[model samples]
Target: SHYFPEMRALLNECQFNNCLHINEPGCAIKKALEEGRIHAERYISYWNILDSFDEKY
Candidate 1:
């Protein structure tokens, strides 16, 4: 959770406040990923770590 401040910052640049960064129109994070601004492995690693926390419960 503490690892993604840049992603969080990118959220602010999203056109929609409710953007989920997945299949949504005008999503900054998605756009960054598409533009190669944000590395795919880093994003996937963050999600993998976050998903592990969900499984702990």
Candidate 2:
């Protein structure tokens, strides 16, 4: 249940409750990534880790 504080804050501001932060409209996380607020490498690493977890379980 732990999440990055910056991501948590952006999620709170997202327009949708079920946003995946990928191709969703009004995604605060995407906006941050586009605006250079969040580093792309960090985000990609997070996604890779999440994908690993999904594959394991």
What is candidate 2's lDDT per residue for 13-50, written digit by digit as tens?
88998887777899888899899998888678667777
- The C-alpha RMSD in Å for every predicted model, in order, reads 2.7, 2.0
lDDT of 1 at 19: 70
* TM-score of every model versus the real structure: 0.65, 0.76
RMSD of 2: 2.0
Instruction: Give every collision pair in model 1.
Output: none
Which pairs of residues collide in model 2? none
Residue 45's lDDT within candidate 1 is 76
Evaluate all candidate structures by whole-model CA lDDT and list the values in order.
0.76, 0.78
Candidate 2 residue-wise lDDT at 27: 87
> What's the CA error at residue 50 for candidate 2, in Å?
3.0
> In candidate 1, what are the lDDT values of residues 1-57, reduced to their tens digit?
235876877877888888756567888887888899888987787678867877997
